[model samples]
Target: MPDPRTHLVGPAAEAEIRRLTRRSLLVGGVATAVGAGALAALRYGPDEAGIPWFLRRVLEGNERLARATFSNRLAPEFPRARAAIPRVNGRYGMAETTDSASWTITLVRPDRHDAVLTLPALYGLPRSEMITELKCVEGWSEVVAWGGVRFSDFAAKFGPAPGQFDYVALATPDGGYYVGLDAASALHPQTLLCDTLNGEPLPAEHGGPLRLVIPVKYGVKNIKQIGRIEFTRKRPADYWAERGYDWYLGL
Candidate 1:
């Protein structure tokens, strides 16, 4: 035999291998410890609205970023030819098949008296229309033509109630579903109290008769079958926000 250990590692090579293995184990142990600590911190951190405190801070930071860059330039309008009917994705307050005749919107402001207005009254303010994309938080969107009065116009005619810092809360008549909007967004010219979709009367399945069409925010904020509206200086409770979703989810 040329050498019995020819195929084997020499003593020096084996020593080097041991050293490398030990170094790798040491590095891996440190990494595992750091990773476990991080996981523990995330799990043990204080909770805000069911979100970890650090994560809520991140959400707050994103909200501030969105506000700092806020602009009136919204998504481009799609032509009527391109408008498509959006899929009905939610049914929180639309379960009841109430007659359209009974539909009324209750408007409230901190200082102003609450006013309940009929659909015809809203139409009386000023008829407006637009074709825009209704983007949902679930990563789907549709180009739909909308008809109603611009929320800005409605607010101007109602009582000019909202301020920059105020919030606008909207809900179905049953209050089973609700969403809050920053006054700035509620006053956007594109926001509308929609009654028609794709040139047809809104369907009940889609929160027909009267719904909110806020093109700037995700569809979650575009409440359907709005039965109540309130303008308040205090931030109102939001449905998705309470469930740990981004509250200020803007497009």
Candidate 2:
């Protein structure tokens, strides 16, 4: 099978590139007329170059707002049909090999206290219900039935109230991939530190030991192979955002 990370970037990047190309062309035409007697390149000027960048960010901002305003609605799935879900994509913060038995989740509190929660600890929490749309940045989506502990419960087990923190950052075991979530999305009614997908344990390739199920944001924000969850006031670094993607690819 092809690498899953490839699937995540192509469509979104292509669409943005095309949008930018058009603006570049239009701006080049205008620049040629203004600097006709001069020798500036016919490529996009600063004004034209700004179009796609601004639009892409604007698109990202729109997604964030939509998610924030989104009602905690569930996505419906069939009672009997089973879909062979795709293998996990993207592997920042995840190792090529992982051992779940040895995995641990760390909760960093505002008071500088640290609490460690294991996989079993998560399952021990009251299993919350969620059936939400997992919108991929690739533009496809699936409504999945997820059963796991509420992020709020996960935090409460350690320290600090759910709503007290400004941000929640999660990373894969390898620490190569990471994502941050705002307080509202972290504590959203539909957010879950999910262990089960489609009523079964998540496969090792699909963030096995633990993964986040955040309904308010796109799938990229639902960092898989979750190794740790830390509460902080600082904006967390995201793997995809550094690659020219939107930092806030919500909804």
Candidate 3:
């Protein structure tokens, strides 16, 4: 008998094989084109212009929405018994050794005047405490009791009128880490120039002497070991934002 393979390949079978082959090639080309398009999107989707134009636009839009709907909404407060110490995530801006007693927060007013403020001065302000959750960008949060003066009060008394400045820039003593905030958020009632945590003086690793506790923003904006604060008309540079993170990381 003739080989079954050879016997099966009649005229009609050859025609069918050609049709299937063409169909397969067409399908494959379409798939390849789709894959190439996806890769290109991943490679070039990010805005490459000087300021991440696309992302900045998106961020600005989000910011506008947030501001338009903004309220004096306060973060929920917990009982002191529910408060827990937060983990020390990073020491990017903290000094190995800090002199809490000698540490002073330097305020750069919008009018170019500089003022040195001490811990005593801060304590003398209308002191406030709130038991709120300190949420981290790394996906963990802890409720802690924070004691300090409201940032709004601080700015009104020592710095410029809250509305005069468009941005607030905070930096560590060594300038290792920094964050920028819009004037509204910086002057929010919940924003605090924190000094104590969990009913005790803030520990060194946890931004002792002074730190920012802003419930309106992610933990990154809660800068530690805050040494310098500037009220500016221009948006100040941010450490994470420069590395492609969203500049307006509102909660």
Candidate 4:
């Protein structure tokens, strides 16, 4: 009911006031929940890198969306002439002391005994080459030429084939960085166990000798200096996942 004396703030103005008041309350409640949940996460979550449970829920929802929406369409390829060197994403697994000559990758397959493969052995396999874009989570991208072995071919020869596993995981020798993948993406035709970049032997800065080049995922999922591979029926733990990043990390 409007008072005739308060005509200046009659129906429209009162309606606006009520709307703003409700919006303020809603915003305040959301902020309060976020703050409280963050505190709770800090006290009980995995580590300070962890976010609020509600945020995790949101990330999980995003993962679900990605799983539903993303396709296995081959990432577009460029002519080798257009390829350029990509910036080094990180060297978490590649230490200054790393000895590529002696590097060996451990493989753990669900259906077979664990095996160790020397880095040279991986390079000698039937070779594959591609010129494609590498997209980073930092909102940058580059077209690069890569030469290596197809992940599917490597798996079919040495480990479980694509459909044999529900998941795959890769890690660096020093255990500093790791990533998990769904089997589908792991065996995508564009996914490679690359050792060459832009027509040159891969430089140490770019995960030389061996690294994953998965065009279907953000660069984070294309782990560097892979020293271990696992084919599993379980969703293996991931380094960024513990730090509040989306586990799937799809493109």
What are the RMSDs of all candidates, in order? 6.1, 15.5, 7.4, 5.2
- Positional deviation of residue 95's Cα in model 4 after best superposition, in angstroms: 2.2
The predicted structure with the larger TM-score, 1 or 3, is 1
Arrange candidates by TM-score, highest first: which order? 1, 3, 4, 2
Give me the overall lDDT of model 2: 0.71
Cα deviation at 104, candidate 1, in Å, is 1.5
Q: Write the per-residue lDDT of candidate 4 for residues 88-125, one digit (tens) a residue.
A: 76777676645678888999998889999997776557
TM-scores across all candidates? Answer: 0.84, 0.70, 0.81, 0.77
With a 3 Å backbone cut-off (N, CA, C), the pairs that clash in candidate 3 are none
TM-score of predicted structure 3:
0.81
- lDDT against the true structure, per candidate, is 0.84, 0.71, 0.86, 0.84
The Cα error of candidate 1 at residue 24, in Å, is 8.6
- Ten contiguous residues minimizing lDDT sum, candidate 2: 41-50
Q: In candidate 3, residue 38 scores what lDDT? A: 78
Question: TM-score of model 2 relative to the true fold?
Answer: 0.70
Model 3 regions lying over 4 Å from their true place: 1-39, 45-53
Ten residues in sequence with the least summed lDDT for candidate 4? 45-54
Check candidate 2 and list the clashing pairs. Answer: 92-176, 92-177, 93-175, 93-176, 93-177
The residue-level lDDT of candidate 4 at 236 comes to 88
lDDT digits (tens) for residues 1-251 of candidate 2 = 88644564768878877887999999998988778734333233232223345555566678677766866555454442444364466666666556668888777778767777667776667887656567788888766777788887777776576456778888876687889877767876678887777779876666776888887778889888787778888877777776656666655
